[model samples]
Target: MDLSKYLGLFVSEGGEHAEQMARELLQLEGAAVAPEAIDSIFRHAHSIKGMAASMEFSEITELAHAAESLVGALRPPRAGSVPRATVDALMAAAERIAVLIRERGRGQQGEGKDLTLLLRGRAADPWSEPVAEAIPLKVEPAVSLRDRLRTVRVRGETLDELLDVAGELLLETSRLRELARQAREPLRAALDESVDRMHSRLRTLHQRVVAARLTPLSVLTDQLPRHLRDIAHQLGREVELSVAGAEVEVDRAIVDEIADALLHLLRNCIDHGIEPPAEREAAGKPRAGRLRVEARRERERLILEVADDGRGFDTKKLRAGAVRRGLLSIAAAEELSDQESLMLACLPGLSTSDRVTEISGRGVGMDAVKNAIEGLGGTLAIESTPLEGTRFVLRLPLNVALIQVLLAEVEREVIALPISKVLAAIEIPSGHGRTFEFQGDEAPVYSLGSLLEWKEIAAGSAAGRPVLVVDGGGKPVGLAVDRLVGQHEALLQPLAGPLGQFPGLSAVTLLGSGRPVFVLDVPRLLEA
Candidate 1:
């Protein structure tokens, strides 16, 4: 029987088990052992052991057995805190397991196996050798672990292919709908209804495909605590990190990109935003600073925030730094709002740190983070208060594959505006076209067609034209279009090659009429 088919499954489950075990062991450090946590950790170790045993991976089995023994010893019929030394040993073991699982998954076979002594934080080979040795154990082989298939995991490439097929179907459906609308008068009604039904079903399929690709942010964030623990010890900073709403799901692509962005934010906060324990205590703040990474859902978007409660950003210092670096003139720097000034931290190479350090003194990470979020069709906002704290807020689309867009006409061209970003669609009478009268503020209005350099069809028309009320920076603006074409769902396709080089365009999608239209990055469009 071939075992290659089972390799992906073993790696996936084994990796998860290793991470979970590490997380639980982290909680046991310098704290009273919770019976449930210990039991959970023990079960995870036992599962890995059994799985490895069934696969006849002697090295993994031995390592897992040693880890299991340590956890089993800690599991209570007795009551006492797990020793810090024991916790470190187990943490190392868990990390070793994760490394081994990843290596095996990548098709890396061991040079050889050497025993790892984990329980005592002693190892014959430091477990650095692939599938190195570990303490031996005698336990019945539970190979049934091989037979239980809990979930069918699909490769990311397979999903991407499915999405491509779906996108093509979307275009075809749109083409069919247009053909239906243009059909002979006698047959139009039935054709229209049939096409609409197909559209509905296609939408449901698109949704399922998108949902299947949703990944909980927790998978990337769960390791943050352990990382923070390690970094705190290195930095001499006492910190309490709170991670919330990591269960919030987002497209897998976003999650993957955000992993680095989140890490950068965390590292920045710890190295710069967070003050030393002594400094914090001297400032009438708690010795341990508070850091939080939180995620929330708002309609079709996800809001992620990373914050630190330490010595906050000093806008004056930021301004001075920007001016010193020639990124901004002295007058320009002074003219900036405090909020804008604080954002200077994102300016490349503009560090306010008194001395340069490998951790963060070079101001590069924030700008990279900003660019990354924006590339994902997201926005990053910076907030800071002197002596208070600094928070970075990122608002990102839930799924980039399927987008709900408000279609509008500009002469013969159809363009898409992300519906989530457009506050409302209204029509202003011919005479009032220059100003947008909302619930009741007058905002500057620009003809969308004119902005696109198209012949303005809405110009001088007796009848009113459609205006998409949009958030222009922080103020309201009216974008007048030739006409409102109703809302439509679009499959966002990446603009490959040179088409991707254009500014003010986020993505392009094909309309039912077989028209290719660009989805405007509203803010960028307005700015451009």
Candidate 2:
């Protein structure tokens, strides 16, 4: 039998089991040894070992066997509570297993390292003695034939192709509808009805396909506790990670793009935000610092927050750092509010750390995190109070592939604005169009014609011109357009090659009539 066919299955199942084991080990490190947790760990290790052995992956099999032995020793009721030393050893073994699995998946064999010494050193204790057999007894040779999952994994590229075809169909349907509008009465009615039905069905199908590509944020976040545990241990600090809204689902593409940003934020929380246990205690706070990561969906956007209850941003230090680093003049730095001074942390190569450390102090990570979030059509903001805590809030689009846009004409060109950012569109009176009362505050309004430097279609009269009230970085701004072309379900195709560098525009889309329109980056446009 050609066992190569099972490669994908083995890697997928084995990877999942490894991740599960790592999470359980982190839990075991904190809580007293539960029979159930140990049993769960044993089963995962056994499964990986069997799968690896069947595939003739000797290194993986050996490592898994070692981990399995350590876990098995704890299974017996006579075995006392697990030691922190044992947990550390298993975590190391699990991390190595994860690395090897990824390497093998990429068709590269890992360089084997003898982990037996490490495993035996931790596993040998009063609870159990090391097995003296030179060669350990093997369990079942064949892999487990379990059918638990009802779903199959599809490659992202395949899904993208499906979406592209759907987009083309929608465009063609719209063209047919336009042609139907020009037909003779009786035939036109029939064609119009049919085209409308097709359009509705296509829209539904497109939505379903897009939803299928969404995975819960938990998929990326569940493994973070293990990382935090390792980092906290290394830094000699006690910190608790509490995650909420892990169940929130986002586009797989968005998840992939923000994974690194999320990691960096978590690292910063540990390294910079959370103080050491001794310091926390000295400050009359709990010995263990708390870090919270929460994700929630609001309207068409996903909001993620990473917060730490520790020593908050010291604005004075930040302002001094900014001035010293030449990011801001001493006079300007002194003039900044505490909030503005705190924002300086996002400036590149600016750190408030007294000395360099392995994890941070090179002053590189936070700015990259902000850039990564913004690159995904998102905005990142910071909030902190001295001696209280710090929170980083990221607002991101729910899906990058498809978006609801308000189509409008500017400078005789059709432009798209994300509907999520538009609060309302209203017709403004001629003279009153210069400014609008928003939340009891006067906000200056600018017409697209004036902003784009195009000759106004109705230069003298603005009696019936549409003004879009938009949330511009938390403040309302009015944007006037020549005409409100109405709402559209647009397939956002990212600009490629040289055009990708263009500012004030994130993507372009083709209307059902085959007319291409640029999708404006409303925030960037407002700033400009």
Candidate 3:
């Protein structure tokens, strides 16, 4: 039978086996030898070698065979203990197999000679080249940042400065269009069309600049497994860390901004939540605690959750601790809801540990984590149950450069409100009162033109007018407009130079008709 039809199955199964091999190797380090673990790995490697040999992939067959021998040498009837070097070499071989499997998945040929020699005790020096470096990962030559980074390093600031100048020049062209509008109607229309064509090109350039700055979440999470292993070793704890959805890409600036926050949260989980191996066994749980880091995309936002199956602290204790530490008075602590009390853990100088350690328990880690997330226009939430578990959730924009905006017409001037911040959009009938009932309470509504006072226009006696329910810092507020212009995807371009002087506007965008529209910073506008 021809083996060509089984290519996909072999690659998929080979990948899973390699992953199991890596995890088993990680378990062997800093722990007692287990013949069962070695046996399981040997079986997986043997299966891979058999499949590769059937498929006539000699390079992969040789690599898997070498790794199988290494694992077999550490099993019973031959050895009683596992050598550290064997585990290291086997781990490298597993890494090589994983790379080779990925190449098979992508229809590429990869050579694993260096790692195969290192595994079978033939190479003079094992560390001369890493498995990841043996065969370079393929990437498209054009537009791939991997190719560009290999030759040159560019700073994000320099990119932003160039974009700002380009944006300013675009605005200057808009000013010139105003002069053209004063000429004859025929000549004015021709000039407007030319400007529109020019604007289209500039917008494409702006989009490229924005995309070039995006960083993959994998870049941020690539070293997480090794980092978690090192931290577990330091804390003298047994933790199994698993990560998911590391392929999502986001603004590089957001990645840099939240890197420390992610680290602090991870450190907190290991330092405080997980119990010692003996304590965990006594508590009727597994000796090793489970820690999960997951990232997923929902609409326009990236939701990141870090959860741990360990002993969670009590919010009652947090409330009492707040009172004891003098961070809050007795009455204030009593009035706080359980969720609010849970957040008090982020307060400086408030820690659950009885003694301070270098890893955490100084009380500043959570505070910094919260602040960093909030600085990126994201919210951080905490949920825990006593003696059960704790989960920290971060909800942030997937792309800060682009936003889904609700376009509305106010006195004939188009405006936008970020959809992420809007609660709902509704229609009001004619003869309705100024106060609309929402959630059993009356929410005061005002016309958008009345609030912004632009051209002193209003939607008086009009029916089917649009009203937006916006989040006004915990409470909802109603803002009605003359008409609904529907929703649109827009780039939140910078307002530089003369355009920067416009108050109460967060960003601006150009419509398909070449008309410029401003985004209302609703809270700021209301405050002013």
Instruction: Tell me, by TM-score, which candidate is best.
Output: 1
TM-scores, one per candidate: 0.64, 0.63, 0.56
Q: How many clashes does each candidate structure show, in the order listed?
A: 7, 0, 0
Q: Highest lDDT among the candidates is held by which one?
A: 2
Candidate 3, superposed: residue stretches over 4 Å from native = 1-184, 402-416, 419-427, 434-466, 469-478, 481-528
Two-way TM-score contest, 2 vs 3, winner = 2
Instruction: Give each model's whole-structure lDDT.
Output: 0.76, 0.79, 0.74
Model 2 C-alpha lDDT per residue in residues 246-310, reported as the tens digit of each score: 98888888999899889888888788889999899999999998999999875457899999998
Task: State the RMSD for candidate 2.
Answer: 19.5
Worst lDDT 10-window in candidate 3: 122-131
User: lDDT per residue, candidate 1, 27-145, as tens digits?
Assistant: 56544444556777899989999987877777788888888877776544245556555566677678778888787888775421332554534422222223433334333354456
Candidate 1 lDDT (Cα, 0 to 1): 0.76
Question: Which scores greater on TM-score, model 1 or model 2?
Answer: 1
Q: What TM-score quantifies how close candidate 2 is to the native fold?
A: 0.63
Task: Write the number of the candidate with greater lDDT, choosing between 1 and 2.
Answer: 2
Q: Compared with the true structure, what per-residue lDDT tens digits does model 3 show for residues 1-528? A: 887788877886777778767866765654455445567789989999998898888888999999888677554523333555666677778888888888877878799998787677723332233445343333235567875667556787987776666655555565656677788979999988777656555555655566667778887788787888888898999998888978767778778887888888888888889888899999998999899888876544678999998898677778888899999999999999878888998998888777688888677799889867755656788988777789999987655554568899888888999876677787766766476666666666777776755332243432367788886665667788877787755656656667554556767887545677898867656655
